[model samples]
Target: MKKVIIAGGTGFIGTYFEKRFNDIGYDVKIISRHPHNIQWDDKKAIVEALEGSELLINLAGKSVNCRYNEKNMKEIMSSRIKTTNILGKCILDCNNPPKVWMNSSTATIYRHAEDRPMTEENGEIGTGFSVDVATNWEKEFFSFNLPKTRKLALRTAIVLGKNGGVIIPYRNLTRFGLGGIQGNGKQKFSWIHIEDLFQIVLFLNNRNDLEGVFNCSSPNPVSNAELMKLLREEMNVKIGLPAPKWMLEIGAAVIRTETELVLKSRWVLPEKLEKEGFIFTYNTLDKTLRNIL
Candidate 1:
């Protein structure tokens, strides 16, 4: 069986990718600070896990749900950049490095937009704390010394699945009949189903031609209002509170993440993936919602 090493394979998306690759007959090797039961030093872990593997997928990161204070921000950046740097070093040291490296990236790197969709090559660079986070993350990811390993930086959108992410809260709110729009509900939110995300990662892992930044999001992104409407309608929720701007600001302060990020208008689109002829099984909001709900 073909082998692949997955850093941060114990988390939500990583777990899904692990299962998908395993189901397809790939010998999946997982690596992390403490991955399930397996243990290895950073340098040794990466090289050993990737010894005969075809690819290395990096998904290590601190969760962004909490406050992004000075210390937490430092931890977030270091967790991703330092781990990536160490992994890159391992690859550079190895005589036979993995053929492909799909480093995790975020779609929030692009400037928020209310109207136009963001293509990989055409989107505006973001500003503020989140942008700084993405910049450092990318800087470290591209600093590896290896030349044999083909790489792709995936600027991914929020993954919506029954098991995780922004949708879970929405699901709870809808179930309790407390669902409503937040902060005017006009900001655009880009999303991809968890299955589609895993499939794209696997596709990129096997496809030698796919490289550089690929915006991994659905072509049809909906505004926050539309997303709320769909969720409430599907969950049979009626009569909910509309969260005002001040509440979201207070939430931002309380949660430690940037208020602007939560309210950022990002109309992201996956131009490169479509151009490269990658098919997304869950593209439409209706289809995706039905599958999960």
Candidate 2:
């Protein structure tokens, strides 16, 4: 059986990957802060896990769902960089390192663009704390010199799935009639179904020719209004209360998350994936929502 080692494999995405890999007959080893298979601090254990593993995916990062205060911001940046740096070192030390290493990156690295979509080949990188975090994370990931291993930075957008993830909370908001167009509702919301995300990972792993940054988002990015409208329809809600910018700021403060999450216009396009002939299972927002719901 092919062995796969995942850092920070206890989160929603990691857990989903674990199940999928197991179903496909791969041995999944998780390296997390808390011991599931191996602890993050255990250098020997991590090295041992990475040795001879077919694939190594690092999804270990502090969740960006909190207020981007001074402390949280530092942690968010450090967590991603530190984990990725450590994993790179472990892979370097390994006698038989994984052939492919998929590191987590965010589509938020791109600037807020009301016109045109950002792609891997021509995307404009943004500024501010979020962008810095993503930029620094990728810098750390690509800094390693591994001629034998193919490294892929998954510049993922918001991933929607069942039970958990960005979906359930938004679904609940829709159910509660709080799901409304955020801010001016013109921001481009880029997202992908969890299934498609898994497929993309598998696709990258299978194809050795593919490398570097790949935008892991649905090609069909919808406006905020369109996204909320679809969610309202899918949830069978007749009315949704709209939230203005000021209200969003207050709500974000109360919830301990950043309003930039909803307000940013992340119009990302998967040109590389499409050009590579990767077909998404759920391309449209309606279909994706239906599958998740």
Winner by TM-score: 2
For residues 24-94, what per-residue lDDT tens digits would candidate 2 score against the true structure? Answer: 99999999877446987889988998888999999999999999889999999999999999999998899
Query: Candidate 1: deviation at residue 134, Å?
Result: 1.0
Estimate every model's Cα lDDT from 0 to 1: 0.82, 0.93
| Candidate 1, number of clashes | 4
Q: Could you estimate the TM-score for every candidate?
A: 0.95, 0.99
Choose the strongest candidate by lDDT.
2
Task: Name the runs in model 1 displaced over 4 angstroms.
Answer: 35-40, 252-258
After superposition, candidate 2 runs with Cα above 4 Å error: none
Root-mean-square deviation per candidate: 1.7, 0.8
Report the CA-based lDDT of candidate 1 relative to the real structure. Answer: 0.82
In candidate 2, which residue pairs get closer than 3 Å at backbone N, Cα or C atoms, i.e. clash?
A: none
